[model samples]
Target: MDIIKKRRSVREYLDKPVEDEKIEQIVEAARLAPSSCNSQCWRFVVTKGDIKEQIIKKGLGGIVLANRWAKSAPAIIVACADLNFLTHKVGAGIKGIEYHLLDIGIAVEHLILRATELGLGTCWIGWFNEREVRKILKIPRSIKIVALITLGYPKGELELHEKQRLDLKKILFWNKYGNCEG
Candidate 1:
């Protein structure tokens, strides 16, 4: 609960690089996440230095100008899904469900929470040129780029602001869709 409360979508970051050990620890957290049918389809690519600059320049150009702030981050983690998992394709065809995406989401959340515990900050970047990222990172055509996350030590002192959220009574239902009480 303390880690959950500390987590925030940090945009600004210090110029210092994130330690490789910390990165490995966060990825280990993701690796332990449960996936649909035990199909661990998620893969991660960590980028820094010149490669990170290329990603920021060529990949995140044009309409995704809002994410330009990611350049300040010392590391960027690219999450990809390997489409070779049979469960994902079969589930999509049978039930119209993209199970790989759900799996990736869960894994990424695990990574983010662990990162928070390590005093690292993260921001999920969904708006970017997938083609450019694939080309820049040399990711194969068979892999699907899920999302990019900027990571580093946050700039300045941590803020004391409370996270705004909808009340559980408004979102949680008893048994039926609209029932608020059991």
Candidate 2:
């Protein structure tokens, strides 16, 4: 809970390089996350130095100007998902549910929590030029790009932004929707 409370979408980052070991540990957490029907489709591309610059230039330009802040991050993780799994495809057709997306969301949370535990800062970036990213990263057309995560040490002391959430009374129910009492 403390780690959950400490987690924030950090945009500013230190210039120092993140240790590879720490990055591995964070991804390990995601690797262990539960996926729909065990269809573990998540793939990650970790970029740094020159490649990171190329990605920032080619993939984050134009309308995604707000994400320019990610340039300060020492590492950018490109989260991808292989949509070749039959279960997710069949589930989507039958139930109109993209289970792979749910799987990716759960996996990303695990990654963020682990980064928080390691005293590293992270931001989940959903806005970007997917086609540009695919071209720059050499990602095949078959895979779906889920999101990008900027990772690095926070610059100076970490100041958490206040998160406003709905109260349990408003969001929770005994069993049915809007039913508070059993």
Candidate 3:
């Protein structure tokens, strides 16, 4: 919870490069995330070098103008979902819920929290040209570009501020929908 409180969506990053070992640690966290029916259907593409540049500039720079700052980070992680997972597909069709999407979210959260614990700044990015990203990575049409995350050491000192959120009473309930009195 302390690490969660300390994290923020940092847009500015220092020019320093993140170590390969730290990157490995970040991915390992995602690997440990829970998946529905044990059907792990996600992919994480950690981009750097020229390909990373193309992804940030050509893929997202024009479409998401407000997020151009992501280019400053030393690395970007793209989360992809392979729809070929049979268990999740069957379960989703039967239950009318997309388990793969939920699995991806859980994995991404683990990745972000691990990055924060490692003293790295990160921002969860969802607004981008998905088609462009798929083209850049040569990802098949069967795969989905779930999310993009920017990561690096923050450019300057950032002090933690109180997080803004609705009170627990408004979001949590006992057994029923209007059971907030609990």
Best by lDDT: 1
lDDT of 3 by residue, 64-116 (tens): 87888899999999998889888877878899888899999999999989998
Residue 123 in candidate 1 has what lDDT?
Answer: 94
Give each model a TM-score. Answer: 0.95, 0.94, 0.92
RMSD of each: 1.7, 2.0, 1.8
Once fitted onto the true fold, the runs of candidate 1 whose alpha carbons sit more than 4 angstroms away are: 158-161, 180-182
Residue 182, model 3: lDDT of 39
> Which lDDT tens digits does candidate 2 get at residues 1-182?
77888888899998899999999999999999999988899999999999899888878899998899999999999999999999998999999999999999999999999998999999999999999999888999889999999999998655455568887788877757885453
**lDDT tens readout by residue for model 1, 48-149:** 999999999988998888899999999999999999988899999999999999999999999999999999999999999899999999999989999999
**Candidate 1 residue-wise lDDT at 27:** 99
* lDDT score for candidate 2 against the true structure: 0.91
lDDT of 3 at 105: 96
TM-score for predicted model 1 compared with the true structure? 0.95
